[model samples]
Target: MVKDQLTQIYTQNELSCMATYSIKAVYHKLMGEQSAVTWDKIVWNRLSIPKHRFILWLAMQSKLQTTAKLAQYGISQSDMCLICADAKEDHKHLFFACSYSKECLKQFKEWTSITSASTDLQQLIRNIQNGRRSKFQKQILLVGLAALVYLVWNSRNSSYWQQSIPSVNYVVKHLKAHTKARIWAVLPKKLSTKDYQWFNEL
Candidate 1:
């Protein structure tokens, strides 16, 4: 049923790929040799992950990291969404199209003046490589995104293991901090501590 709905929503080729197997297999099979590695590929590889596992891992990481009330270390389906409190914990709501994440993207676009392609993860990856940003800027953004993803994952682990709520502000702060450490130089500061705190309180 879900596959049929996805097929109707997307093109035949997209439907076929999305339905054939796991998203990772689809990504590797179709995207492995696309000539140009997109922002998604760059970000995924930066995390030292294989292509297919990266997709699922990223999505899961985003949600699991933010949730503070779930048990510290077990795989279960009872976790609740930390942001909206209206849904179960899941990947889709944690990353691309979540309401809170959308707000975060909105702030990102306004600050960077870089328009994201779409809320769809696949499209984000596809469009990021082809966007009009400079190579330097693209690399910076890619690194920032990668850091943010990893930080979010780490924050989730902290919440689960340490019984602490890792706020979005901490996530963003750690992202900037780690990015700076990695780049080893001063870069333009995009998001602020106030912004991070506000996002957490939202």
Candidate 2:
């Protein structure tokens, strides 16, 4: 079967008799090419914490096991948000729509000076990317946003298992610390004086 598949691909590409074998060519032909997503840089930013990036990636894809998803799978009986306890718990509400999360987002925006009015995760990312902020500023904002998502998800889990949710201020404080430290550790050497000063004030 493998030999037959290889022959099919070879014929489809109309390879010359002298063409060299390429694993890359074979792989792309087998799996097809995927288009790039706009959130790729936001979720995979180099300055963001690895675990935070991972959670952001999952949250961006709506794959986090929120109570709404759990209820749909019969693993949970309650779909109410653990943090707010007033709405269905899902990726959308857990990120910023819930009162607790909205407060956290408000604090984050104040810190980063992100002027976009969006509370939705994906839309906010698009806004940041398209905004007029400098590259460094945008990176800092993305890092902070990623940290918020991670902490908010953690708050939800705590509410579930520990029967406690962290205050929005507590989450925001940690989010600022984590994002600041992460950016400082990998800070680019060529940052402009203006950007550096802005970061220092944050």
Which candidate wins on TM-score?
2
**Steric collisions counted per model:** 2, 0
What's the true lDDT of residue 4 in model 2? 75
State the RMSD for candidate 2. Answer: 3.2
Residue 26, model 1: Cα distance from true site in angstroms: 19
lDDT of 2 by residue, 1-202 (tens): 9767788767755666527777887888888877777787779999999999999999999999999999999999999998888999999899889999998999898888778888999999999888988999998988999999999999999998999988888999899899888989999999999999999999
lDDT of all predictions: 0.52, 0.90
Stretches of candidate 1 off by over 4 Å are 1-41, 44-79, 82-84, 185-202
Off by over 4 Å in 2: 1-35
Give the number of colliding residue pairs in candidate 1: 2
